[model samples]
Target: MYIPELYKNENAEEIKSFIKTNSFGILVNQTQGKLWGTHIPLELETNLQGKEVLFGHISKENPQGESFTDNNEVLSIFNGPHSYISSSWYDHENVPTWNYIAVHVYGKIRIIEGEELLFAMKKLVDKYEATSKNPVKIENLSAETMRQINGITAFEIEITDIQAVHKLSQNRDDKNHNTIISELEERKDNNSQAIADAMKKQRS
Candidate 1:
């Protein structure tokens, strides 16, 4: 994550909050000299030792799941809304660019199983199901259905480093930034509107 000083987001709490909101992220690592990646839902948590950790699960069939080992380094990427920024929106001449928010978390991986895996699965279900009108309880599953949980692999990552960036027209003047936001909001695409909202929140 090559981030310019103007766009870098160094606030630890803010970064953690972003990850919590956008828990579905890409987990990447190298296996047999080849790069492997998996799209998984993850959460930022504190371990019993009071250290920040990441928890997630992968399909048993995914080779990346088997590749993880104790202390193996991995990268988790969380992406936020983004859209094209036209140079015409700027008060001064500028090149077209993409504005977005992203966070890169580097950590050491540790595979988890049995009761620990069940605990992690429960946490994931509770987090997403909280917004449902009628949340489904994981414990409600029958014994046979619960046995299917073994088909997934659970893992934890102890966060070692974090890098985040919010490229929301920070290089432009107030007027130009406002122009970009207005243009984005006027567009029909939800992604554009999302970027507009992010820019507004940052400025506010």
Candidate 2:
């Protein structure tokens, strides 16, 4: 994550909040001279020391879970909306670019099992289902279903480092930035709309 000083976001709380909103991320690691990656939705938690820890799980059948041994170093990437910024939107001559939000978390992995895995599952379900009209509850799950869910290999990572970038055309002048936002807002795509919103928030 080569974030320039101009685009770097140093706010720790903001970065954590971004990860919570975009909980689905790619977990990357290496083993046996090969690279492996798995897409998983993670839950964030804090230790008694107030340090951030990440919780997530992968199928026991997934070789990535087996690779979690040895306290291997792992990287999780959380990506937000992004869109192309056409040079045509700029007042003067310039090359095209992109605007987006991303966070990289590096940590040491440890596998968790038994009641801890069940607890993680309940937390995840409650978080995502909170906004639904018919929210799901852990008690609603049958014993067999809960056992099946527990079969997955849950893991926790005590995050050692974090890097975040919010590249929302901050390098451009006010006029150019506003122009890009306007054009993006007019576009029907969700990514463009999201970029526009992020740019507007940055401006504020």
Per-residue alpha-carbon lDDT of candidate 2 for residues 1-204, written as tens digits (9 for 90 to 100): 899999999988889889999999999998556888899997787643465689899888888887778547999999999999999999999899999999999999888776666666777898888999999898798888777875588888879899999999998999999999999988979999999999999878
Clashing pairs in 2: none
lDDT of 1 by residue, 50-144 (tens): 66789998878887876787328999999988899999887777689999999999999998877767777787888888999999778887899
lDDT of 2: 0.87
Q: What is the lDDT for 45 in model 1?
A: 74
